[model samples]
Each structure stands twice: as C-alpha cells, then as structure tokens.
Target: MPDRDPLIRVTAMPADTNPYGGVFGGWLMSQMALGAGSLASRVGKGKAVVVSATDFAFPGAMAVGDELSVYCEIAATGTTSLTITAEGIARERNGEATVKVAQGTFKFVLLDENDRPREVAL
Candidate 1:
C-alpha cells in the first residue's frame, strides 16, 4: 500500500486459516519465500536456494477471505547470493488496508547445474 510494486497476490482460504479463522504464519512465510526466490532466480538467471530469513515481523492478522499481496525487491547481491526484502499486505474485501501482515528479508544463493553456488548473473 506504500506504492511499491506488488510481487504476488493470493486469497486467504479456510484451509489456510487457524482455529481462530486467521491465516497461519507458516502459510504467509511460504508465500514470502516463493516471492523472494522468484526474484532471486530472475536476477541470478538460474535456480536459487533460501539460505536465511534475516528478519521477519507480523504487524497484523490475516483473516479468511482477506486478499493478500506480497511485494519483493532485491536488497543486495553477493558473488553467488542475494538478499531480498518482502512485504505482505492484507486487505479485506470491503474494507481498507489495515496491516502489513508480514515482512522480512530473505537470502538466497544462486545454484549451478550441479546445485553448487555460482556467480550471480546479475
């Protein structure tokens, strides 16, 4: 909601909800990984592996039926790795954006044909 480019969008479903009808943290984390990995691979020009979640925070809850949007951008690059910052925004179907359900820094290493670290393409 801060005008950054959106990287992914998904709806919180019943299956993703917890007993209290809120989306599970693991589910949101997985989405962030996917978004970060996707950007890393594109910049690395090959497959990548998540090495660390350098930072993570949950500003609010994501309830079932909420529309979730994930935004990711490369924050840094190493010889064979990259660090990305991602933010997840949750918006209700009929209400305003209330929170950033999740945000974090994800590190990924570029891999070669043999699954070994290689120089980042970018």
Candidate 2:
C-alpha cells in the first residue's frame, strides 16, 4: 500500500470488464489519467492539460468486483510543466491481497486563463 493516500479509488464493475470477463486495461489507464489530471490541476493551481503520456506498463491483472486505487506524484517540475507518475493497484474484493496493476508517466502543461502555457510557479 502507498504511504500517501490514493488520488482516486474505485471499485471494478461488470461494465469495466473486457470481453474475456477480466478487468479492462483501458479502463484502468483512464482511471489513472483522471487521478493524474486531478493532481496536475491542484499542483498547477489552475488549468492543466496533458501534453504527453508515456512508459505505460501493465504488470498484473485484476477482476471485476476488485477495488482499484490510483496513486500519483509529481516526479518533476519544469518552467511550464509538471511530470506526474501514476500507479494503479488492485485489491481483492473480499480480501486484503493487493497487486500493482499498471504504471505510466504523464506530462502536463500549466495553462493560463487564455489557455496558453504558463510558467509553473512552484
């Protein structure tokens, strides 16, 4: 488990399953993106838009009814961007067992009121 609290936590549902009845990787990635975006907006203190997402890896699998937690951290800060690393962990629905399911890196550019990239103030 992460020492810091998760940015977002959600339960896998039937609709979140792939055609083979297992949890879908795309859904997991979207959840991680959502969490990363939330952090970007907060850290940027305004609007932020993802300019790149890379280095995605899926090291585990999960099933419907499991719970998914997304953790994110600002890995780097640039003059006008923040690089966030995100990890997805899945816990068994009925037990405490957990596994790391996915990871990726996202770079977001802070945006000003007019939607232009702004300098990162922190």
Candidate 3:
C-alpha cells in the first residue's frame, strides 16, 4: 500500500473472479469508480455523477482472497466537474507483497437537488 490512506479497501472474493479464476477487470474498475465517486461527493459536498472515465490500464493481476485498495486524488476541478485519478493496489493474501493492479481517471459533475449540474465550491 501507499503511504497515504486509501479511499476504499476490500478483499477479492471468488465471486469477483472471471471464468478463468483471475480477478475480473470490470470488478477492479468498479472499485476504482466507487472510490473516485466517494471522493467527488465529499469534495463537492453534494451529489456527484460520473461524466466520463478514461486512461484505464491494468498492468498487474490479483487472485482471489487478495486485498484491493483504491486510492483517489483530485486531478482538476472545473465549474461543475472534477477529474479524479484513481489507483488500485493489490496485496497478497498471505504475504506483505503489493502491486499496482489498475489505474484510471474519472470525471464527475456535481449535482444540485434538482439533479442539474452545479458549480463546485472548490
């Protein structure tokens, strides 16, 4: 794991694996999205919805029972949107080894009560 705190952490279970028994790429992306969305909501101080996601890459792999940690940080802030960079790290189930399994960037638009895009405070 990195020196900074992770936005979210969870274990990879058998249900999250692909047919070949490796962790599914979609599952890792979903975890990254969840972490980014959480950060967006907290920083925006209101509802936030994903507008776009890009720069996804899976450079490593993890097996079932491994622990996945997603770290997110704000890359940019617009009038009504935020671009967040997310990294997924996987820790071996029975050892202290860790590796970066996935990385991506996500853009989210802050929303008001009416569900319309609103200005971000910061």
TM-scores for the candidates: 0.92, 0.96, 0.98
TM-score of 2: 0.96
Query: What is the C-alpha lDDT profile of model 1 across 42-81, one tens digit per residue?
Result: 8888899999996889888988889888999989888888
Best-fitting candidate, measured by TM-score? Answer: 3
Candidate 2 per-residue lDDT, tens place, 90-115, comes to 99999999999999999999999999
Over 4 Å off, model 3:
none
The residue-by-residue lDDT of candidate 3 on 1-122, one tens digit each, is 68999999999999999999999999999999999999999999999999899999999999999999999999999999999999999999999999999999999999999999999997
Q: Measured by TM-score, how close is model 1 to the native structure?
A: 0.92
Sort the predicted structures by TM-score, highest score first.
3, 2, 1
Off by over 4 Å in 1: none
> For each candidate, how many residue pairs have backbone atoms clashing (under 3 Å)?
0, 0, 0
Ranked by lDDT from best down, the candidates are 3, 2, 1
Candidate 2 at 109: error in angstroms? 0.8
What lDDT does each candidate get?
A: 0.87, 0.95, 0.97
Position 27, candidate 1: lDDT: 93
In model 2, pairs of residues that clash are none
